[model samples]
Target chain A: MAIPLIQFINVSKNFGESHVLKGLNLSIYKGEITAVIGKSGTGKSVLLKHIIGLVQQDSGQILIEGQPLSQLSPKKIKLFYQKLSYMFQDNALFDFMNIYDNIALPLVENSRFPKDQVNKKVLKRMDQLGLIDIEKKFPSQLSGGMRKRVALARALVMDPEIVLFDEPTTGLDPIRKKKVHSMIQEYQKKFEFTAVIVSHDIPEIFNVVQRIALLDDGIIKFEGTKKDILDSQSKILNDFIAGKDI
Target chain B: MLNKLIEKFGEKTINLLKSFGRIILFCFSGVTNIFTLPFQFAKIIEHMWFIGTKSIFVIILTGLFTGMVLGLQGYYSLVKVGSEAALGAAVSLTLISELGPVFTAIMVTARAGSSMAAEIGVMRISEQIDALKTMHINPVRFLFSPRIIAAAISFPLLTALFDVVGIFGGFISGSMMLGINKHVYMDTVIQSVKIHDINVGFYKAFAFALVTTTICCYRGYYTHLYSGFGARGVSLSTTNAVVHSCIAIFIFDYIITFFWV
Candidate 1:
């Protein structure tokens, strides 16, 4: 009954001859973790990009907090970006900047926060992620898990209302993946912000997300509770569940 | 085969026009971006380190050797004309007016421009540019403007350095090697080269700097618009930046000459 925080209304996108997204309609509520599961190259990342205005839809509308994103000018779109944050799959921290500066960059660039305040916020986030000791380390110096954690900390530095994760659990060992999954759960619980995760790692994401959306052939085939996804009888869903088709 | 060839050529021509149009847009946006953030002195200083200080050694080496070669060649030509004392004027004029800025930009294109394309292209593919946008940071103001401002400021100074060193090279060749009277050689240069020539050279250098930096940054910034091998995309952009910079420098040089003459 509540107004959804983000909504995609008949959204579609095409890259040349290939249609990546086709009339995809979905809505995400505030303070909920919604996991989008799909095979590789199923336009999961492309869908996430549209939420943040990185990629534009060819048709339909993307609404953030009920305001149409497609109708906004570039300047207004940029203003809307302050409320949303995206953590890239590869944890694309600027290699040239140290971890502290990487996390402090948004604050220094956008907000009126003084240097000392920025440093203090960065240090606090570093401490929260148990990365206080690695403040001076560059992205090249950190391990894969450490880099993702640092990136997540940076994403949360501005305390955005929504966070989108692109394959957050990829390239991690089982234990590290579990840790990352729990970290997502922990952040969601603490902040009560909207979280949309795009991943193929179903089991890990299933534990955190309340609803699962399965995408195939440029369409959302199913959208329901995690139990509905587990007990799905749809051939496409079964094929995805058995890992028989991508 | 004929149809395929025509199609390919047509595509290339369209692409060329598109590139030209994009560059005009980039220049307009760059001007607006500078006005929007007129107090970005710290960023300008930071990019001075990247675009100026980082390329200093290459610029100096290219300038010195170019001067040395010009001195050697000009001396031989002047001797044939029985005007060996005019070596200084010839070397200084050529180096300052053409070789100094153009060669410096080309060398930088090979070094810094290629690296910049690679760095920014990788960032584009990786979605780092998107991250900047999500944080409400304008990539043009944060990334591109500093490099443009830095190169514009440094190119003229480097051209001056090149001119002085080149004339010194000519001085050594004429007086020491060819045994021309040192006083006469110096007097010939001082009399033949007017201050207007120096002013024109600096103006041309400034224009060259703007062209080179704008092209390189534009290529790197929009590299993702092209497909296929990412490395190949970067390689093509680097080549385009260098070729376009050279052609633009010469074309602008002719226009300036037309007016100055």
Candidate 2:
């Protein structure tokens, strides 16, 4: 098999008495859009976090581009982190910064991109993301959808090899949701970057995501194409697919 | 019962040591990157403006009132011994040696330090810090070092301002109000106020700045890890940051004074 772009090797995580991930093993191939679907409070976000080393596994390891995340030293970890970008559920844009500066932060801070270049890059990203007339506006000034787009612009400005989206369509209206999903699909098609999205918007994302991983009881119960999940014999998986909490 | 008590004591002791070790490690990390490459000159300027320049009004007001009170109180006490001439010496010494640095630090801990904690705590909860990490930026170096360095630079200057304003206030209260020989009071203050006294105050101010900023930043940075998340967590961190900064400032002030004096 082709080497996995992202790998969770029997990972386990516990938040006090709550075990979020238990010996969970999953892999994402390069240039593929993988959707991680599970009930709320499952470790889907936690798994995304582990990919970026924002959180650690209590047992086992996560690997990005074949390098184990846990084994990397702090210096190496930072270097490794530049390869992946996480688009948070809340957008997590700095409210203090305008759209331009917010998008340019990673570039400016990490790459120390020059002022003129930073301006050009930020403007280009904003234009591509259809964020016009909002460059100077702060995150608080924008609508939720606009803020999400600005955050996507920020994440895309860095242009990492992998982008993890946490609930990409959680709070958007249908039009905005389709807009976001289409943007993700178009971006993934163009950039060919590995995309792992943790989302609750069911069959809606079915058309956008190529593969689906069903997380149940802290373990991935099913990993297959959307068609395979649709045809699965597992009643719990079916229950979840039918939008029922098991 | 005895075994359980021992177990509880051991657990608490271990937790304390763990927290102490983490603080030390965080401080070391901060110190390592403080003067390193990619120094945040703009951020430091912004923080200095926030922590120092903007705080002038309050510092001036506090200094004026504190000095006036000291002068008024010192005159009555010194007059009982018929040593009213020593009132200037008392006010200047009290300010230059202790009150200037301590009170200025306490004020900063309340204003800038608490706000810094709250800001970072909110960032932690909102995952802005995590966003920074994903971008390969050291959140501590980016979010914290500037504030710490600014506090270190601003504290001494503010203390100096406090000292000067306070002396003027004392002048207003003493020579202007108490009917003392104005020239004598001025002369005593000018002659008796040695550089050692001012030096000690500046040194203590620097120490207090480090204590306040470090503790406050630590509280904010680890609030999510130690406490929890959301508004309640941020509020707790802000409160704890101010209280802890005050406690640390007082303890360090005593320790530094004992050793230096």
TM-score of chain A of each: 0.92, 0.93
Instruction: List the lowest-lDDT window of 10 residues for candidate 1 chain B.
Output: B226-235
DockQ of each: 0.78, 0.87
Model 1 Cα lDDT, one tens digit per residue, B176-202: 776878888778778878888888888
Q: Going through the candidates in order, what fraction of the true interface contacts does each contain?
A: 0.83, 0.93
Off by over 4 Å in 2: A64-79
Each candidate's TM vs. the true structure?
0.93, 0.96
Tell me the tens digit of each residue's lDDT in model 1 across A93-196.
99889998899999988768888899888899888777978878899999888898888888889888789999887777888788778878897899887899
TM-score of chain A of 1: 0.92
Those runs of model 1 whose alpha carbons end farther than 4 Å from true positions after fitting are A65-67, A71-79, A230-235, B1-14, B227-229
User: Residue A223 error for model 2, in Å?
Assistant: 0.5
TM-score attained by model 1: 0.93
